[model samples]
Target: MTEERVVGLLERLLQAKVGHDVARLIEKRLGRKLEPFDIWYDGFKARSGLDERRLDAMVRERFPTTDAFQQNLPAILEALGFDRDTARFLAAHIEVDPARGAGHAWGPVMRGGKAHLRTRVPKGGMDYKGFNIAMHELGHTVEQVFSLYRVENTLMAGVPNNAFTEGFAFVFQARDLDVLGAGGADPERDACRTLDAFWSAREIAGVALVDIGVWHWMLEHPDASPAQLREAAVKIATDVWNRHFAPFMGVKDSPILAIYSHMISYPLYLSHYPLGFIVAYQVEDYFRSHPLAENMERMCRQGRLTPDLWMKRAVGSPVSADPMIRGAERAVKSLLKH
Candidate 1:
């Protein structure tokens, strides 16, 4: 998609209903004006209601080490919607290990090889944070296994791009609390989730714009030095931050957006995250009446279809953020009334 089209699509979340309502909800929850650090806000998350220490204890009790998590993959997959046979088959094709750093997934190229999952497991045990990251990585592992082994042609073995994979990661990560049996369904909980998705998507949209802006700047000033590029990056970040985030946050000219290493290392990859979040929301909504594992198998096997066609085939609609915005609008209004 073109940068303008992507930007325009994401900016819808920043309008009167979704973004502003999230700010209001945050203000009410915190009983204070938004701080710069509020960009990492967690109050919208259901787990925010639970003590972190308790969650850590629970996770450690369940997964005292990486091996424990690896062994339980079948059960975990079953809990997430896969039947026992499918869960066991998926688990059989995946291996897990401890990570010194953050969690990640690596898939093998050939059919006989396995998908590898890595997550941090401390001397003490795997805690809530590590488990959450592991769940995210598990999504990637599952997608890899399906797209690689299940597809007819190994050459067409992945989704549209990294954004689609990230979307899959988000799908599993969003269910971590539920997988632990620590989450329940209710109107407010559902509302909070809707708001959470909107806030997070809106949060990344500005950073994506800043990334796009800096790329355009670099192209126009091809001969610029590192110092000049850095300065231009800061200016572009400030412009994006002011236009998108400052008003809602009541914080002005924050250069936090400019500091992401993705600008230097991955360059232009930040846009994938917001788009991924949009894709995740759409997928989650599609699962309301549809069975996830059935559709997941059906969709992941579609191989290299374009994202629009892939989404339309899988969910009966093209990938877009309108469903999330509408849900967030309904959620915020309902919560406000209550």
Candidate 2:
């Protein structure tokens, strides 16, 4: 059968099983219809005149210091309510053996272990992207450590899935600036941050949609050939691209979505990107007012606590638009105002 025909059949099967909610959610958030070629296109270029180079630089300059990270841990753990023993345990996990190459996380809990953090910098990255990734990974490590040892059981340890963890990870990832001592409530920089947040939210939200739709398609079309699955993925991605980001790029049929290796290797991980962004916002808000002592270890212990319970107990709310979309919008608006 032709690729299009096979995809159509797959979509039918997916809709039958997982329902069309994923597609509908994508359309609702994006506020438009998706074409088959708009998926992977970067949507941020149109706003802020920012480029990846600058962002990368920002990440590199920050997040390499044990002292800087230490200063922030108390507040971070306080927000999560971690204790001393747990803090030490988590600190040990993130002790930076240095032998472990860059960008490595130990154990499922990202915090209980240290990340190798392979920075592009010859002397070591001192830029935003690298720092962002490091911090992002740190957030993952924090959540990982908390969930694994802090929480009750392995079964109840982290959030629901990769998407939930990703959300928590993004909370720290977005804080690269604050961690680096460069970001804050400054008007101009805050506007930049706002723009970046919106752009990222849209981008990841789209990716999550694609991830959900593709999986739903896969689950339904068990008999679908790999080639057919690839085709379906492309179409969905393209459709997503045009719907949310087409106007900014002024281009269509971008093969960008094809690059999401996560879709192929980590089933259901795509949802985490957008979910992580949302969850991160909520967590950040929690830290804005709340403060923790040297209890990194205590926070690390609360792993996998269902999204609902974790959010309610951790921040006193259900996981919803407040942390994801609404919270983001508020942060962006505040940033823009300054």
Candidate 3:
């Protein structure tokens, strides 16, 4: 079911030629023709316009030390609608630490041990990117706490897969600006956000196809050397780009998709990101009409169901691109009018 849903969405995306149209729109927005590497285009995001140094300054002031961030976790949770008791409970179980590398969450394997949220914080302070990553990891820690301490079965103390946790992390990451109390309410930004999400989903879907295709190529040439594998990787990435991206971007056989470091280090793991985005969009939409803190608690406590069942239980729908596509279409129309 999951495979069919993902493949079906990919096929529909290709057939609809939405990428070509969106590319033209993006070019208009940028005042230049699209480049092949524009597959990673981020100009639609509201934060793209903000000065990075200014944002970093704000974050550094807010979290001057790792302890500052750790101390504010309860307040952060409460700002997201958690009651004081629940916020304190979550904050108590999560230990924030400065990371030696790019940040990640480490959930406790046993009860009573704390979940670690690690993100890089320089000696001076936490930068904007570090703060953003910390919020994402905090989402993972929160979900870990709920799924571990709140679930009925100890054996089932996690979400179905890493993708679901990534989804939850994305939900928190999306609210980073809100947590900072930085942006005023703007309905127009919602449309921009939808377009941003659609473009992102399309970009990662192409990368995922390349990732999957390379694995299949490896299977076909079992005795292939490292040099041969490198060649095959580039070929596979180029082929995928031609099929999915060339028509839209006016480029042929661009090996740009092969640029992801994960293609070298993490085999067949790229699909989870696009899947996470899909699940995150659905989860975010659901939370718009429901209480995020309460719904997230109930959903996380569901523990280790199949992905489809977990999503259905959490959002009353299976994981699908329909909502994102529909929303993007409306956004595109609205954007063109203005």
Candidate 4:
């Protein structure tokens, strides 16, 4: 889709009304008025107040080594709502590895090859953080396996872009607590989850718009000096933040939007992330009532279609911010009452 459509949808979600609701929600949680840095507020997460060390201890007892987690991969998938047969199939086609640094998923390019999930495993054991990363990477493998082996075209064996795959990963990542037997379907926690999805999308949407602006600037000023480019980028970032973020955040001309290193290293790829957040919210919202295993497989099999088409065929609606905003509005209203 055109950047214009994406921009319009993101802007619609970033409306001052929704921003105000988000501010109120944050303030309610923090027992204070909004601050400039409240833009990174994560109090909406279900695990924000839970003790991480207790979780780590629990995880270590359950999975004291990489092999322990690898062997229980099928059980983890089953815990995330997949059936036994499907979970076994997925687990059989995926391998988990110990990593020295950050975690990531690497899908096999060849047919019949297993996907590799890499996560840091301390000598002491696999902690909660490592297990969470494994869940996210396992989500990627789910998409990769279905899209590659279960689709019509292995040649074009992928979703439309990076966003959709990343989207699926978020779907699984968000349920890490549920897998650990920590999260539940309590009304307040569910609402917090919905609002967290919307708020995250809102935050990244501004940074993404700034990314788009910098890309367009480079296109228009191919001959400009590096210093000139820097000046224009900062200007674009401040303009976007002032317009979208300042009204609620009470921060003016904040160049934080342009501070992402992706703007420097990746070049025009930053938009994929906000799109990922939106798609994840959309997909997770749909699966709330639908059969997740069947529908997730069905959606992945529609490989590489136009995003809107894929969304329509998968969910009943097009990819828009309305659902997210409405969900947030309901969440904020519900949360502020208590």
Clashes of each: 0, 64, 0, 0
Q: What is the C-alpha RMSD of each candidate to the true structure, in Å?
A: 1.6, 8.7, 1.8, 1.5
List runs of model 1 lying over 4 Å from the truth: none
| lDDT (Cα, tens digit) per residue for candidate 4, span 1-338 | 88788888778878838668788768776888776667778888877768989999989998988889889899998998889998999999888888888698888887879889888878888888787777788889899888888888887687888889889998998889988999876888888888887778877888889888998999999999999989998999999988988888776888888778687689777778778888888888898889778899999999888889999999988887777777787888888776
Candidate 1, run of 10 with poorest lDDT: 9-18
lDDT of 4 at 190: 83
| lDDT for each residue of candidate 3 in 1-338, tens digit (9 for 90 to 100) | 46566666665655455566678889998798889878778888867767879889999998999899999999999988899999999999999987899799999988999999998889999988888889899999999999999999889999988878999998898788778776667666777777787898888888888887787888899999999988888988898888888888887978988878696589877888877887888898898799999999999999999988999999998777776777777778878877
Best by TM-score: 4
Residue-level lDDT of model 2, residues 153-191, one tens digit each, is 666665555655676566566555554444556554543
Off by over 4 Å in 4: none
lDDT of 3: 0.84
Candidate 1 lDDT tens digits, 1-338:
66676777677656545677788789888999998667778777767767889999989999998899999999999999999988998999999978889898998888999999989999889999898999999999999999988898999998887878898899899889888988777678778777877888887887888888999999999999999999999999888888888888989989888878797789889989989988888888898789888788888999878888888998999888888888888988878877
Give all TM-scores, in the order shown: 0.95, 0.63, 0.94, 0.95
The 10 consecutive residues of candidate 3 with the worst lDDT sum are 10-19
Residue 130, model 4: Cα distance from true site in angstroms: 2.4
